[model samples]
Target: MTTNEETIVMTPLWLAIEENLLALEGQNITEENKEKTVQKLVGELDGKGYAVSKSGIKMMALRWALEDMLKVGRPMLKDLTKALSELTLEDLANPCHASYRVTDNLGKTWERVQKTDRRDALIQMFEEAKLDLLVQKAKGLDGDLGIRLLIEETVESPVILERMGIPQEKLDQVHADIAAEIAARNKVLSLLETVEGKPDHEKVKFLFSNDIPEDLIIEVAQIAQADIDKAKKAMEEELKEQQRLAEEAAAKKKAEAEGPALEDIPMDQMAEHIYAIREIQYFSDVEKEIRTMCEQSAIPKAIVDLSFSDPDKFDELEKQCEG
Candidate 1:
């Protein structure tokens, strides 16, 4: 029922100093670095957005002032540090309240604990690094970028994980889970690369996982079939081009030849030259029709089939398919 104004209390400097002094009281300190440490603490607090009023600054500077204060200050702050240290499934259920109890670290509850561990460990890492910061980053990044950053950071960090206190078995599970995810991602990227244009949902899913909509599956299959058709047509056109070039080369050679004096020319040689010319002319005609068919569809199935069966008669086949 408390409003923000009613609930929010300016953290007193005496309280801040009391907490710091208690933590440092256990440490054996030399007097030479006391001022330097105090200055550093103030700077860190300021950087963290704690307002440094004159009273707050002076209270922080005075060690006796910190010592004289009742140690029964905010238990919430100590709880926050402990929460960060032994964060677990149980502790997560507690809202910020006086009666709420924190949980101890627990054991695994799943068969694929490795995958579960990686995500769980990453969550702990995110909590340590500051969930609020992650939320800010997620908000700043568009959906894809945010997801990418989250995955990359989770996969990379080691320090925050040391505090996670996950068992060896869970650690092993994390590694396996990360490897599986990396492999899946690579497969998705590979499939995306094969697509000439913007990738569709079906192709992405097919490449990455077995899950796909019936409509998307049908669409991808059609795309693959079309690609096959294009390849066939390209092959046919290339064959035709090769034939044309060969004929042209042969014609040039024949024109330049002395012809072995027409009377002396062998019958076989004459027949071979005639055959080369006819073949060249046939391919040239086929090449034109193939180009036309490519304009209609990258993988015109009927055209491709005809081109595969009788390349020399591709023009006639293409005309028949078009008709």
Candidate 2:
């Protein structure tokens, strides 16, 4: 073959490793034989095209090197290394903090290298070495290996849920609900702070109070009355119009069906009707609990005095008592 043709056909030492290994597999090779063979393979790959210096070979070797470091790394970092070794694509894309990202990437690269042939075998060499010693040495430098060890030692350890008495599903839902409620209430509470005074904070604290606050009756009434007045005004107008039409239609239908005019229909009393219905069923369990809590709790006698006599004076208290 011509020099150019020979050069093209000749596989580099790294490239020829597979062919050589396949040839060696048929022979009876022991531990000593395997070592000599690896040395020979390295020399041949180095001789042909100086494969060790090539980018592909260097990349492959670097990967193998990282894996070796992991297997022999210190005990403290062993868990971190194992965790890193198991990372998937989803793990890589997650928006983790920056330092964690670096450690994850190093683990991913090592895993990928371990899957390749020459690189895989090279890694085994290090895994068989004194891994704990290598890891100890690694912690001395701020390399990928060192960061991994540090992370392993410092990361918050996972608590076993079973031991903590938390069901996994319950824990997950609690996390999600807390996140959602916090987001939703943050803005409302912020506005309450700016527009209203710290009354909201006090109200929150007193919400479950056994003994209602001395001022609770007056405060609840003032707030509820304002809200009720606005709602009543709007709802009354709408309900009146609806009632007027219903009365006229009922009269017309009844007169036609009976062959005589129905007596003047009573004016719709929907607003009062709705208020009565609402007032009948208002007190919540929370309110009842608070009322019953009077034994050990200091309930403002003023609120208790007003609530028992005419709860309607405070709309929510009325609802809680009635509901």
Candidate 3:
């Protein structure tokens, strides 16, 4: 591209002129204000770094505006035209217009046009408004901001759909769809509220999984209240019994690990134990163990050694073993 084509110069004077000239577009000028208008244009261009004639300023502004229109407004115009053309005369005549009515000099009025009209009068106004808004944004703005202005106007068909119009049949379908959604939401809400007060029982879970209605679940919950209570009490009792068994077992194990104490037994029985320890291989050192037993029982060594060496000599040993 040429340097002039590649670069954009946005000095205050050219911008002011461009803005003023754009504001004058689509006006029906009369001879009375013609000279005044030209003078105003000349005055706006007078105080700039460079001097330019009134005609020159007007030409450049118009060119810039036109270029912007082609680059941005044309695509938007095409899309909106498509949006408008989609509407039938039936859509335009829908009493719904009372809601979207555009008001003006005559008060609130809805325009009704024939299906075969050569031009859609309102579309022209819509296009011009959108076009002017985009052109305003194009001034001294570039990249995403300028591009965004255009993109924003090019809204998808899903939005502004009322402007494009929909048939009564499609409206009915939408109504049915909305009803279904609301009903499903209500069911889910009811289920959620119901489940919160209920237990995580398999029966309740099964009922929910099968999509049983809330009223039925409420009735079942009433019948199962006693059963649920019974089940919970039974579970707690079972856990307590298990804990009792564990404690009893632990006590038994501790008692078994610790043999009978010397003070807790009589001398004769202690003598018999020492005799039994002699016969059993449980004592790592039999002689030392017998001595410890003799001292703990306060029995004489001679007596213990005799009893441990000859179990038959202890008369009580036979009866105790039998017992």
Among all candidates shown, the one with the greatest lDDT:
3
Question: Global CA lDDT of candidate 3, please?
Answer: 0.48
The prediction achieving the highest TM-score against the true structure is 1
User: What is the clash count for each candidate, in the order shown?
Assistant: 2, 8, 0
What TM-score fits each model?
Answer: 0.23, 0.21, 0.20
- Pairs that clash in candidate 1: 114-173, 114-174
TM-score of 1: 0.23
Which lDDT tens digits does candidate 1 get at residues 1-323? 24665865434444454356556555544467755656665665565446443455464444443333223332223443545555342343322221122221211211121233234333443354454344346447753454344445563334323434335565556567777766655644455566637544335444435443333334444446454445446657878999999999998775544234433545464444334334444656575675444333333233344454676665553344344
Each model's lDDT comes to: 0.45, 0.43, 0.48
User: Per-residue alpha-carbon lDDT of model 2 for 227-277, expressed as tens digits?
Assistant: 434544665787899999999999886545433111222213322322433
Model 2 residue runs over 4 Å out of place are: 1-80, 83-245, 252-323
